[model samples]
Target: MTFNAVTFTVFLVLIAVVTVMGFVASRWRRAKQADRLDEWALGGRTFGPFVTWFLLGGDLYSAYTLIAVPAAIFSMGAFGFYAVPNAIVLYALGFLFLPKLVSLAHKKGYVTLTDFVNDRFGSKALSLAITITGLLATLPYLALQLVGLEVVFGALGIGGSGSWFVRDLPLLIAFGVLAAYTYSAGLRAPALIAFVKDGLTYLVVIAAVIWVPIKLGGFGEIFRKGGAALAGKTTSTLDPAIAVNPSVYLTLALGSGMAFFLYPHAITGVFASRGAKTVRRNMSVLPIYTVLLGFVALLGMMALAMGVKPHDGNPQYAVPQLLSAVFPPWLTGVAYAAIAMSALVPAAIMAIAAGNLVSRNLYRQYRTKPVSAKSETLVSKVVSVLVKVGALVFVLTLDAKFALNFQLLGGIWILQTLPTVLFGLFTKRFADRRALLAGLLVSVVYGTWAAYQVKSATGGPFGGSTAKPFFLDSPIYIAISALALNFAVVVLGSVLARALGAHPRAAGVAEEPVAASN
Candidate 1:
């Protein structure tokens, strides 16, 4: 791959522009109480529908969605189409559930889902479970974003050569700039950057849809050529052959939809909305991005049609290579910058969400005395930086290919919170908080162990998220199986606890705000 100096310069200028914009965003809305948790972490929860739309879209569709979705299609064919349907299903579920959750969080002054858990259940044990699971799940998700950034860096020919630190220097510097603004401006940084991130995304996707097919002689030729190359590959493109296990595909799609909003960062987006109606309105139109994702996935087929061979046989490079083949150097740089910035929006959200979880859920608990609002915000800022650093280290150490499963694996851990997050939304007393806590514990361990036992086509453990438990004839999504076990424990364990007279930590959910006084 040849490096273009103009393209690199354009990309650098874009990054610098966004970095300055991120810093300026702390003053965008110019709140009176800037250091308070609500202002810093939730952007004062005043974002209107227009801003909320971009923010949610930016946070939801990360670089992983842009990079890995197409990469999977390039390598795995029809199976990777899961990213599209699952996104559609996710919005439908979110439209139904998110307004209510956001309302509860907003009404109760909850910064993190763990705050809601503490208020609703009155149990630190349950809150701890939610917070730990969220952080653990989020780290890999953050790592996947870095993986996306690295992919763009490599495509742009700036994946520097030499030792480990030297090679990732570009990525590290970008992340460093991201961290500085995020720390200074908090959620507002990403909120402001989202407009740029999403605008470029639409332009790049639309351009690729028109330009790639035109370069390859149109969609008809693309399909004809791509289909021929993908022919007789049962798991190939256009075959609709997901895998040998039909049930597995259905379960995987359904589970992916269900687990999408349970991630803490997702809930953070909901919490950041102006009101429940803002969320409802955004979900109504959020599928615009979903449609965009569909076209982006087709870039894989265009790659095949153009005969754009990947670097080092790694198909993750297919889309980047495709861009270089079809588009001018400047446009390719724009496309790469769009993809790279996609990581920043979601990565920032994830870190801020984790920072909230730790500062409020974890750090607040251990304090011998009450924590000050300024201290809380400071701690959150520090934690956000550490989270990014941890993700940077993770992507640097592990095989980038492993990141394809990061979202799935993260789902396995995050899905255990469903009984608490999704269920707690409707009713307060579905089961004992203790039973729910126990259920979470059981599901996280079981789901991970189950997923770990399943071997990939390459014969390694943690190969995938689909597993065949003894109760099923075919492999099903491990998250679904683990969720079933969670509900079972909640039901039976609650009954047993009731029989033994072990009561809940609180009888009814608290009405007062859970956040500490400012």
Candidate 2:
């Protein structure tokens, strides 16, 4: 794709607008103690429903999701919708269970998910387990966002020449802009820019849903052509008509939904909310993004109907190419900018959330010396920078396809923490800290191996998220399969710990009272 001056100009203008917005975010909801961890890391835990609606929307439904979902649908067919059903269970869990955690967080002044784990179970080891898992899972997911931004760069013809440094110079500048605003404004930067990212996304997707199908000769023609093009060679259910191997669909959706909120950014958004009402409000409306996602996913089929060819056979380019082909240079710029901003908002939030986990849970939790709030915030801020640099390495060194699996790989690792972080929120039944630790350890090992066993046609081991289980006839998501194993271990361990008179060791931290818990 050759460069278009109009598209590039419009895209840069929009990006400049948001870059300024990000720097200004520090004052949007300015707190009394701006340098403190809670204020800088969490937006002072004062977000209301409106800001949070876009914030969570921007955080969870990111450039990686927007680009990858459509790319999957474009290349593989209806199987790509597997990532969509996650929203149903995600919001249901959010509406029912998340508010409970929110209330607890409000009472306890918890900034990180590990903060709650440490307080509830009285175990710093359990907290560190969650912290390590959060960091490991988040770094790759963050790198995947750059993959999305790089797509926009390709569409604009901005790079792909000169030395490695020259080819990626645009991305480096983007990183610089993102790092600047994020370091300046912290969580507020993303919270503010989310409005722009999400608004432009909705605008572009709304246009594509209506316009792209029309160009493709309507939904009927799209399905007719798409149906014929998408037939599978085996029982993989590549066609829209066949939903065979429904177990794969069900389990992936369930696992993804279960793991969605376990992400550090998700929990950070929740804690930033001023109250449970804000969370419930955000949850009720968050599915708006999913609805948009369904439409975005349809672009793949639309591309098929129009016989849109991918550049270099990379399906990830499907949406960008389609947008550039169908829309004028001006709207193409808007669409490209939307996708690029999508990466920045979530990346900023993820870095801040990971930084919170490190400074609060990992480093601060075990420090022999006292650390001031400002110093702790400083530590987190620095960690946030280093975290993105590490993510850059993942992007520069590895195949983006493998990097794509990093989120799934992260999920396999992150899901291991569910039994420790989320389960304890409900009942003390799974509250045995030693049992929880063992569950986390065992699940990480098993999940990694399970995912490693998956060999893709193109991507090697860790090639895909779904694979045939040893006992199951159909392939299942490693996160779900491994989570079952995680739950079993913890339940059995909890029972044995009970019978053996072992208990959760108290960490001697005083608790603040809120709503009652079991």
Candidate 3:
């Protein structure tokens, strides 16, 4: 099918308008001091409830959610439902948990989760480890966002021709715009653009929900046709862990529930709120998006009706392909643009968050002296560009399937930090810094090894998925399991350290703020 050139043009015009709006965001929240890193990176920590809600939603749903959920359903059938529940669980957990994190952040003037890690563990090295791990994990996450944008462009016929260079033009342009505003306005850009992105995303999601059914007969019909084929043809269904294992499901739900906010970029959104109250209020309301997610996940079922298969070269293309077939050229163009916009906001946030880690944690650690605020800010901006470039390499070199799976692998890797970042927020129980380090190392190896063991098809003991269950057969989130191992090691190590009389740091660090929102 062909695109509605006129509609596509109008969509581009709207995105460009929003892009410029983001560029002016710094001025919107400008304080008297132009050079303040706090204002630049944390949006002056002054966003009210509405902005915080949209910003957090935009950050969370993102291009990944927009594209990946439906793609999962299109490719993997019932397994794809995990993403929808994961999102709901995340929002629900945030509602119950975020206010405290936000309160502590506000009180402490914290700009990143690493700050909290440093304060809680009272260990610079552990914080530095978190900082590095977060940057590494998020870089590919940023690349996946770009891949989302590229899929939309390829679907909508946005570029000159179908060549790789042409298809990728939108990604390059999106990256440039994101980098420019993020450099100039920092968190303000994403904070402001969140409104546009969330607004468009909500509208597009609702429209697709309504339109897809009408276009494809109905939801029941679509599901009936699709579910039957999927049940038999899928790689494996017997292994509960790999397919629907209860333990795997519960672990994934709980692990992601715990780790979602622990992600540096995710916490960055919380840090930008005006106060803890705003976070709590927003949390109460954000579950409304869970409704949208239900609809969004259904798009996968719709894709099945349309016979949307993962492209040989690009798994990311499934959603866009499904949408293009289900909608008129014009509406499809709008949907693609909306998804592209979704990619831009989160990519910018991840890049900035990652850059901040490098500049503040790693670079400053090695420097002769503390870097000036201006230098800190400048270094962040420079590395943001470099990080984006590195992500571009991932996009170019890795197959889309490999990239997506590897990203999930990265999540498993980063989840190791949950104990140090999230649990450490409330108490100092496992007070040994060395224990934290050991836990982190254990988590990394265990999670990666588990992911390596998972296979596409289920079979003999060794032949099954990377997460070869000493027990189950399902798509248990590898990252979540890794986190458990990380925490367990920390517990064992702390026990040993205490018994061995390893001198504790003497309550050695500056006191951590007692609240999540400062």
Using TM-score as the measure, which candidate wins?
2
Candidate 3 TM-score, C-alpha based: 0.90
398-432 per-residue lDDT for model 2 (tens digits): 88876766677898888788777556666645457
Model 1: how far residue 307 lies from native, Å: 1.6
Please give the distance, in angstroms, between residue 388's alpha carbon in candidate 3 and its true position after superposition: 1.3
Model 3 residue 75 lDDT score: 63
Q: Rate the local accuracy (lDDT) of all candidates.
A: 0.82, 0.82, 0.73
Question: Tens digit of lDDT per residue, candidate 1, span 144-223?
Answer: 89988888888888765888788889988988988999999988899999999999999999999988776778899988
Off by more than 4 A, model 3: 1-3, 158-167, 231-241, 309-315, 455-466, 469-475, 506-512, 515-518
In angstroms, give how far residue 39 of model 1 lies from its true place. Answer: 1.0
Which segments of model 2 are wrong by more than 4 Å?
232-244, 456-459, 503-513, 516-518
lDDT of 1: 0.82
Backbone clash pairs for candidate 2 read: none
